[model samples]
Target: MAVEPLPEPLRPAGSGPAWRLRYLSTSWNGHPTVASGTITLPAGTPPAGGWQLVSFGPGFNGTPDRCAASQAGTPPFIRPLSEALLRAGYAVAVTDYEGIGTPGESSVVHGPAEAYAMVDIVRAARRLAPVSRRWAAAGYSLGGHAALWTGSLADGYAPSLRHVGTIAIAPTTQWGLQFAAAGNPAAPVNPAVPYQGRTLPVTHPGGFRAADWFTPAGLDLVDLAGHVCIEQMAAALTGLTMADVFTDPSAAMGEFTALFDPHEVPVRRYPRPVRLAHGTADQLPAVLTEITAGQLAAAGTDVIYTPVSGADHFTVAAAIAPQVVQWLEELFRRP
Candidate 1:
């Protein structure tokens, strides 16, 4: 399929930071695609040595325009995260993903499309700047799932781009289990409500309203379900047993069982090192990380699992930033 032309570049609205923001049009499965965001290079830094690439996946269904890196809002999320990486001597690329900024709804379903967009964004970043192809992937919640999925298939997606390592902080690993636990027998419920601390907006284009799908008490129930689902999915996908959710012997033995099982994916199969962090008291719980660690370890991949005793999913980042940064630094140092 012929790729679409790039969008016109939007000038930086302010001089908060010296960075370049551009739009690159690329193709995924023959569809015209546009990825827009800013790339931050360290001040007085020359691009002689190949720069390390950090491709970030943002939480929930956030648009790249909202990232701190784009200078869209006061205290951008991407800006702080990217600055941390830049101070650590890494070049960063933040993708708006398929639907966040340009057009269409984000491919929330964990499939080839989201994975393709993420991989393409990294390539697009390299083309737009003087950066080495060596890369590390990181994300939170939904973005975490994308990072792991991309890291799992990095070799085939972009052979030129080195897959240094990946980090998934409080990732949403199992959609099917999450939905089922959220009291939806037929579909996955919205995973954004708990993080937002209120019922999700009913105006969102996605089907189903917050009130229609979940009661007041069901809000907390959905959070619990999300926690259970992530653990179960990791367990089922990785051939580990984190819980008894899938206890039916016949259901457990089926071939396609693990596809929907969330736990059967074995995320560690990707040809690179991996790190996972979760808080024990997190609204999402730390068992998900434990299950993830078990599965990755079983695959013989270099894995680092941190169980923060008092932190919740939202607060784990601050508590574990030092470890996360060190792990990423080690990955980029590899030849």
Candidate 2:
């Protein structure tokens, strides 16, 4: 494979808290793609110790531009996180993922493609910066899933990169469970549900009714249509018992049984440590901490599970930022 040249003056000169934004084309899910982002670093000699790399998977339901380093908001998304990591002396790489920067629905499919993009961005970052091969993955919500999946595939995708560990905050761990919870008519409508791999109905009262879950640009029509189907299915079985929801429970079981069981992938196959943090008060009915811990333990992978007492899905990051940063620093320090 031909190595792409690093852009001119990769890190800006005289950089006391400075960052450079650039775009690079790399292979993701076995296809050539461009990932755009800002690489932040403190003013100095580029850290002679060599920097650690952290690939950040932003939360679901927004375009990458919304989370760009310079985007304005009450709590700036990438800028704050990127600056924090840079202050901690780690080079951070944030991908717009495959679809967020360009056209097409962001692959909520949670398959090899998203996982591959996470790994490739790290590779691209290492080549672009003076960063060490030792690395960690961090993400929130849908990103939490991406980080975990990327960490899971470290051994296979980028064996050369040291897979230190990962930190996933309030991740959607159990897809099957989330789907069941989402189908409940009495359940509070979750804006994030459309990001998952389920179809929903727009007309359903309790379904996704927001114009845009993230911004006011309006919901993507494709995502809106997908949610409509899922909502319809959920409403059809509204008053029925759990057992009655399926005409053929076995077939329903078989469908999800084959696709949603990510734990079956074998933890021994993963080359890095995994850490999961979730809020116990999360409105979403997924047992993220327990499920992730159980799967990792069953597969004999090193896992750390933390459940924030009063935190909910939305507030998980603020509640766990200190601990998350500590864990990330530890991963960077690993030999």
The lDDT values for all models are: 0.55, 0.56
> TM-score, each model?
0.67, 0.69
Model 1 stretches astray by more than 4 angstroms: 1-32, 61-80, 184-268
Best by lDDT: 2
Candidate 2 per-residue lDDT, tens place, 183-241, comes to 44344334433333232221122543333222221234224533343334334334544
What's every prediction's RMSD, in angstroms? 9.8, 8.4
Question: Which of the numbered candidates is closest to the native, going by highest TM-score?
Answer: 2
Report the C-alpha lDDT of model 1 over 71-132, residue by residue, as the tens digit.
33212323344456667766666555554555443334334445566677677666665777
lDDT of 1 at 268: 49
